[model samples]
Target: MAPAATAILRETFGFDDFRAGQAEIIEAVSRGENVLAIMPTGGGKSLCYQIPALMGEGLAVVISPLIALMRDQVCALREAGVEAGALTSANSPEETDAVLDAIGAGRLKLLYMAPERLASAAALSLLRRADVRLIAVDEAHCVSEWGHDFRPDYLRIGDLRRALDVPLAAFTATADEQTREEIVARLFQGHAPRIFLRGFDRPNIHLAFAVKNSPRRQILAFAEARRERAGIVYCATRAKTEALARALQEAGHAACHYHGGMEPDARRLVEERFAREDGLIVVATVAFGMGIDKPDIRWVAHADLSKSIESYYQEIGRAGRDGAPAETLTLFGPEDIRLRRAQIDEGLAPPERRAMDHGRLNALLGLAEAQECRRITLLGFFGESAAPCGNCDLCDAPPQLFDATTAVRKALSAALRTGERFGAGHLIDVLTGNATERLRGLGHDALPTFGVGREFSRSEWQGLFRQMMGHDLLRPDPSRHGALRMTEAARPILKGEAAITLRRDTIASIERRPVVRALVRDEDQPLFSALRAKRRALAEAASVPAYVIFPDRTLIEMAENRPADMDAMARISGVGAKKLERYGAAFLEVIAGEVAPLHPARRRLAGGEAGPIYDRLMEAQAELARGPGGTGKPLSCSHAQLARVARLGAADADMLERLLGERRAERFGAAFLEILRAGD
Candidate 1:
């Protein structure tokens, strides 16, 4: 008598069929079994619970950790014509009343709340009257103490589930064996749930790693190649996020910064802009990108190394969630590796835990230094085997390698001769025969290995040390403030009993090539630009995120296909009935050349009261080009200059003159001031 899951999948979600393991998980959850689903990021995990909720009898309560995530999902489900609501501190009083009313009337099929809300008795009493039949835990790994994003509030989820006596379904993208065991024990109360371990292989995402060489320039170059696409740049520190964002903005990208230290409102504004704007890059610390559901992020770059392999996977997984081709670039260096080691060694975790953490970082280093396929090595870390995916940088341009057994031994001998109590800088100095006061003070001039590696340049020796760290033959000693120390793996090489080959290309010079290829053709670039213009206008008019109008993937499809009418537009992947109805005609007009592409400066001020104001300001400035008496030479401000004055609403002549300077302000200040006042 129940409607089949396949029917709901097609009619509601517009998918022809369920993705791998989705149908099975949904069926199990629908049968009232507690479920633990370890699906990959962008692997359609939401549907595993959404469809079952719709097929069942009462409201499915979802416990999400992030307020933004809850609001995003609630909006998306509503757009899909489903009855969903979220209760959070961000919700207005009227919104909360409406959700409570929906629950009392049994009109809502799904209700979303944060894990912290379960701690309040009032929230529980209210939920007790809502006819809740299912509890869904999103980002369920946060409940485990060993997880990267541990939440004290997540500990309350198990008690809530037992109090409600409802079926619980848990989901996360990055959970290791220990985290998974903790989740089962805590949430399921030691009773094993029906587990679905979808393999963690994102074939659509191209992977690449680079050692930091002119890191700012490297990141800028990466952003330039894929201009006007949504991307995220992750930094290791809050200050780096701000600095990198400023650098990116000065280089003419619509870049912004986000971190936990920022005000809540400022962080929320950045989140909203990133969701809505096109080609906008967010340089952020690890504080960002936990539960962001944006599907069209074209690329993710690490301005610095991530803390762990799990952190690396989760950070890069934010891109290409729409099942399109996305790219990733991670830059690491000796300094980054040393910082990671020190962080692990200095943590309050037990000795065994610190050992596990070191092992994990070693795995990440192995992937970075991999000679064969980066993808295979990455997957193997998660207990999955993969073929040599041609999508990674290593497979595309195989590195040129050479016998480096002699070089590695020399480096190891230098470290040993120096007492293994020094960092890479001093070690490199000793290898390159660079005599310093410190080296002389330590009496390193008399050492046997001093100046023995002068055949290679200083930079070359640095690269050799980096490769050594990557090989786990050398690690930073945290107790001694990051002194170089040899591991067991280096013993055989030091004894001349083992031969090692290192990448010759990496030591010679850093490769500056663009890792991501162009997704669209040269010929279709014009169309792509036009489509982006249209999306921006629509997003500004609606005051929503640009992707809310249409994601980059959808726009790319529109450009490639040149959809002639509504019927053709409806067939595009993201153009559901709602989007097709709202934006179909405007976009079709762009494809048909019915609209002219606006200038980039004007585009920023378009689609609101500011558009007409900008036009008036431009007209006023043109009139004042030759001055009020029409007796002086033509003097004008640039479009950017005009736009800044207009957007800020320079109220009077003094403010206007301050922005345009005394000379140009003398000619056009009064006129610009008049135009602004008229708009106000």
Candidate 2:
């Protein structure tokens, strides 16, 4: 008999307890139910599916987006002795042979592949023979065309699910309400799954933001404090990554740069070094973090502001995955905001999407110039509320606030007087009493709003303009070369119908501190290092990443508890049964412890007379989808409708017609009723 869920969780995963909301989701999934779990990035999402795979009888196919992610996960599962393998374009002939042999022998319990593989007929045929029982989609938000990480190949998942007729569980960390609805429409065919929207709070990560003042120096200083720690520095452009990597290296640190423009071999080498070596820094663009599985990232620094709040949360989430404290510093300026606006306005998206993109950016800016706790502003974006988190910069050092209503009004008037065709630079020139040649050329020196406010310096005016953009009072028009234009939301402030306030920019007064604290106590430091050394040796011998053997958190637990025997070692959080059998002796010497069927839709009504009736009704519906002769305009009944018909205890032509519509009933009412009555 198959093991119970709790037994599998204890023996295979070594966790004595489940995190908040995990037990309920696992229970639903174990019952062969479709699930959509939206948990935080480091919230142990992989375990929800992994445990089910271990408890079930058939192979659970995982649809992943990247080969790197698949490789890391498969290796980790094998370390726990779960018998996992992956098929990707990067697989060698010998490796593919081994995975195929394992599948044929029924020795593999989990199979990981990319979404693009679902389009291949050979892959579908192989899955049919493999007796697949469940489909788990990682990064399921990629199925939505409206999402930032949308993948065209992900749209094929729904078709694959229908072909296999299996229950599917989709998991993602960053889907909002619109994205969630899109996922349901595309993936589950509008059939809502048992969804679990866990809290979005990752309280272990500290949040902070600073306006750009020598951003290079700012990033450098931030890095120097956390020296010899694994971190990522995200840049806005390719050139910036290279320049910053060089600057970091010149400061006598091990730093490298990565971006999409690099050669595939070069990128692979960087990925290897990052996984194998500790204390290595990689300065990269947004393309670097999606597939990274490292859990000990000490920090993440944004050299330039992120595109939106979703992107920001996702990027920063790479740090502190071990449930340890990590820090984030994001630097922004007026130019950064302008660049983001121009990028959004100049895109080829529809007007509605452009407007939504602008709104998303405004949300990020609001967090940047926030006058209260950063965590509150960040979490509020995802429709959650919480008390003040005393870990952010605002909580650490609250900002000074001032009523900038008059200042915002003056900036709006300058844009209006100049025909709203100038960028922030020119507007700043006109507002700060600077009669530059461009302003003189435009003949704007005698306007009513010109030279009316010279109290603030040029820098102060620039800061105020940034705050105005944050409040969404103004937007940059791409058609006019990024000219600042007032939005409708600004009309109230300009007409004195509303008021505004902003945090006084104190860039020069901010101090630097050590954000990266020691992960373990000093007494346990030596043992932790020893455990890591052993892990590195094992990973190198197996030609896999060090994290594949054991994550840093597991090692920390081992060092702290100092398990002396196999049973005690099996009690640690990450020490599964397989791991205890394979490496328990060595770790003890080091004083370690620790550790779908049916139309998928109609099949949900299984285990009763409705199952066969649903199938017959489906056949009838198919026959009538194009009318009696199959030459009229196409019509069909939804899966939900067919299920409803199958469940009816007694049905006549009129009742079937009511459920199946007049045209469908006229075409196949007799056959549909015959099948329904037989089941009754």
Candidate 3:
């Protein structure tokens, strides 16, 4: 009835063979297999339907949540010589008429629209008349309210599928057993669809998560390490997004902020700049990162904790789509949990839902604290079992651990002895037996367990408390902002249901610490200022955040290496394709004496500033590079602030009290100070 699908794949799409699972799905859809494809972000999910549409007698309909994504897909389809067009709210009367005409004339092979658009009776009627052969839902997890990025309107998708009586392929990257069931219930009306999950692993992108301690400073320190790589930094609110973007710019980055409050024109400029520019860092709220086609984002960083694990996975999935190494970094503090809890408590969801959300948050926290392979923890969260992934931070550099049964019991007894009314600080004091005023007033010094924990330092007690929280033996009551409370699991630790072993207070990892570069000149203001000038020019020309153009690390590297030409510059690791082409001449001019083009052949993860940390950085980079909010996670402070705290080892409640304000130190103080001392 129409051109064979293989013909389109071979001739129109210019491909000799389909990727791993495309043909199978296409054949299933061709034979009318109702399908649910759980492919990773860059797994060629589109081809499943695109190839089938080319063979079908009628037009294939695609439902996408992002207007930008729809437009890009349509344009790409047309470029492949396929008659494809999209209908969105942005369409004018003329544009709408033209698309309808193409469909009615049977000239259009594919049509894309958002699920919200189909709610209109007019759109439904048009679908009734149009020979809609297959329905492809991109980011289809939205249909399930249980999903992290759930959209209520997406619940209407199954209705539309039934109305058209067509085979539908529901697609998403992170659907656990529960989410998969929810998707089926919503999309297939309680019937299971053929499921294909192509091992939820993106080996190219390395994943890393860091607790936010002095967010702003840590951000800079982290970015400085991989200055020339592209990345995204996410914040929670529009205000934080704006503030962070400005701060990044001042810190010598071409950073641009994006939020819904900005005029559409302004947002579009930021978007274009980010898309075209290599190594661009976009600072924005969740309003930023959906369906963006930017493929080169090498890292994703969250200044805060995400609302749910689903959001975390989806946001981070944006990186490494090009099958190259990228990093994903998230900096979270204690306040993030509070904010997320407050959001869930206030949402329309029921109490059960709220508790479920709390559990999920705890899972995320556990994942963060886990010393095992990060990928293993992540897969476990999604209801899929995975053995240790050696590529993660924990695997590459394992943490120190110790049996802390005695220590944990001392802390628990202190909490119980104090009747659980005191805070972790007061509790830790009783264990390490710090004779603070509160301890003396409470007469804890007279107790048997008091000072028994003197064998361990005060900071060790603090680390034990954090690990306990991760184990779910302790929870901070929201009303009290995490005043010590015993969860049901506490019985196990207290009564030995499980033996408590703790990670040896490994607050210090060498790689996590800042290394002062020996080769660089100190206080070389003139040269440093010149470097900033180069960064700004390159950032503006590429329309990316200044750091994306040339992170401080790259600039520092350039000043040290002083490569003479494109070739030598290329050899300076982190200077990838778009970089060498666009800003090559300007930098080469600076180093003209040694000018010569290095081989354009790509480099590997070998000896360089980028070699060791590239993969972890890429995971965080992709997570924060999603549509609006980047990672759409909660906020701490600016990256600069985090680095500052990390440099200063402000450990425990008292040191945090002295160094950081009561509010400032509590969130970041604990983590950053740990990192600082450990690095030292």
Candidate 4:
């Protein structure tokens, strides 16, 4: 590892050791190699670029997808005493001005922006003026048209990279083989990055799935078991999220709903609350939870099936982020499958993309009905192999498996005999010998396949049909009002040349699981609460999220260890030297029941090599304010102007005049240039 990276890792970020793939990634980024790192959620993707930003020359421009994430990370970086700012639509004019001024002054090391901003000519001008040396793309999968969260604005990033001619490092938590290729084609434009596939396993998360039986009741029961722990319940529709959130509230839980349809301010409020509050449940659509950095979320539940296996993994991966045991419960049903299928079919995506989408959904359904470890199935989808994990629902209570070959054959025969003009409901009705008037009118009751499946109950047959869909043996044809269509895979089974097995979906009473603590031990609970209270007060005073002040994991460590002094506190995991110097005293007092108090002018210069230079420039500007003869009109430059002068390498009277204007430069320009030269 590079010494500067190691120093920043320990003193700036407060980590003695790097995570699995971070050291290698940091080394490559430091070497200015184009890198594409596919790490799991909570795998420290931000640090890969952040450490490089601190060590590299010129500004590091980070293109992100969400404004809330940019704001949060900017706050956290500032708290760590790093010179970072964001140019986003959410900023007030004054905030934007400050960011521009900082950029002009060479005072910001990291600049964050939403990808959409890059489309503006003014934004491009600002980047060129900022002299960005590195481009880091977060949520890099967004660049892929084949991915679930494709952003058209992201497609412009390659052009920007070429114009800037800087090495690019792209990072994301979700990208399969196809999505990865699309990303490379779109972002790198043929030149591939040094790829790092840090496996997709989140071992701390315990995965579980259930067939939806009164899904509302199931979700409520699950929430009740983990009451007072932060969790997310994702729904398929905005209306469903609103209804479910209300239901959760009625059941006496602190719950709220989020979706893209909500006002931006409302969405921002929910994002803020999610970052600041603990034990609050957020019922939301897939629109929520991207770029969320909060690490104490205890669980995630899906009230509806996700659109794809990648979506499922990304959603559930939001939990147990602190490497603590977090759990997931996904409730899927026939309706969810049908709805997902219809959504894909109705989208404007090309036929091939639609087909790929269906394949992805089938993979998810296969996981839903997995007979072995959910982890194995999930990881295997990302081209990994693993033994059966003891943490999934199937491992906890193995399902009753049966030889389903005969039932599948009978179902396929019924579909074929019925001319495949009906959906599973009607086909199932015909198979169970339901001699409705319509069936008799069509003379379908006389078919040999009719009544052949009378042995299985209607619900059992429904489950079997769902499993068949999961197996890709049957498809719902949108052109025919979702009629049952047999795939080639079903022919062998229908012909008795193939056999299939399925897990019988049984509706059982909800088993109450023991409530688990969020993170700290029982004895440390009170201290943790106190520490959180302290953090909340600090964050509120600073007008930032609680995690921006110090994430829950750091506070949890504080509560558990109770470091009594600054030196001891600095040894804590997240107590980087800057944070320790800025906040270590105040937090130490809370731990011991006990405390830079830097001027704003000097504070912003903390991490860069320009702090002392800024101080000297300030002194020079003051000394020459009234001119060398001490007879001119009193004059002074702003802190920004002083910072710009301090950061300059070679300067002249004309340049200083342009920067400071005629009179002020005439008075202070000579001294300023001399000081800058001396520092050089």
Question: What value does the lDDT take at residue 137 in candidate 3?
Answer: 87
Worst 10 residues of 4 by lDDT: 506-515
By TM-score, highest first, what's the ranking?
1, 4, 2, 3
> Per-residue lDDT tens digits of candidate 1, residues 1-680?
13578756654554555778888899899999999999999889898999999998989999998888888788777766789999999999999999999999999999999988988999999888888999999999999896678999998888988999999999999888889999999999988999999988998899998889899999999998888778999999999999999999999999999999999999988987887777889999988998998988999999988888888899999999877789999999998899898899889999999989988888888888889888899999999999899999998888889899999998999899888999889988888888899999999877888898889998888888999998889999988888999999999999999999998788878584646666678899889888888888876886666766676777878889887655466566566554554566689898874644455566544433566677788888778788877777999888888778878754777777778899998888777777888878
Cα deviation at 415, candidate 4, in Å, is: 1.9
Question: What digit string (tens of lDDT, one per residue) describes model 2 on residues 1-680?
Answer: 13477767766666767887788887788788999999998888888888888787888999998787898888888877689999999899999999999999998899999999988999999999997888999999998887768889999988888889999999998888889999988889888998999999999899988888889999899989888778999999999999999999999889999999999888877877887677789999987887577888889999999999999999999998878778899988877888899888778899999889888999999999899999999999999998999989898877888888898899999999999999888888888778888788888887777876688877778778888887788888778887989999999999999999887745224544435567789999899889888887888888877776777888888888887655456667777666666666677777733321124454244334576687778777787778778898887778888878888968999898888788778877888888877776
Clashes of each: 3, 7, 68, 1
In candidate 3, stretches whose alpha carbon ends up further than 4 angstroms from where it belongs are 1-19, 92-97, 259-269, 341-348, 383-387, 444-447, 508-680
What would the TM-score be for candidate 3 when compared with the true structure?
A: 0.71
Residue pairs with backbone atoms closer than 3 Å in model 2 (clashes): 166-596, 167-596, 569-595, 570-595, 571-595, 572-594, 572-595
**C-alpha positional error of residue 658 in candidate 2 after TM-score superposition, expressed in Å:** 67
> Which stretches in model 2 have alpha-carbon errors above 4 Å?
1-3, 507-514, 562-568, 585-680
* lDDT of candidate 2 at residue 394, scale 0 to 100: 90
lDDT of each: 0.85, 0.84, 0.70, 0.85
lDDT of 1 at 327: 94
Q: Tally clashing residue pairs in candidate 2.
A: 7
Which residue pairs of candidate 1 clash? Answer: 228-279, 276-545, 276-546
How close to the true structure is residue 605 of candidate 3, measured as C-alpha lDDT?
Answer: 21
Residue-wise C-alpha lDDT for candidate 4, range 1-680, written one tens digit per residue: 98999889987787778988999999999899999999999899999999999998789999999998898899889888899999999999999999989999998999999999989999998888787989999999998776668899999999999999999999999887888898898889989899998988887788888888889998999999888778999999999999999999999999999999999999999998887776899999999988887777889999999999989988998887766678999988778887899999999999998988988998999898898888889888889999988878877777778899999988898898889898888888888999999999999999998888989888888888988987889888889888888999899888888899887644233443424435778899888888888887887788887767777678878888888655467677887877766777688777786532345545545444566788788888777777887887888898888777766777889999989999888788778888778877
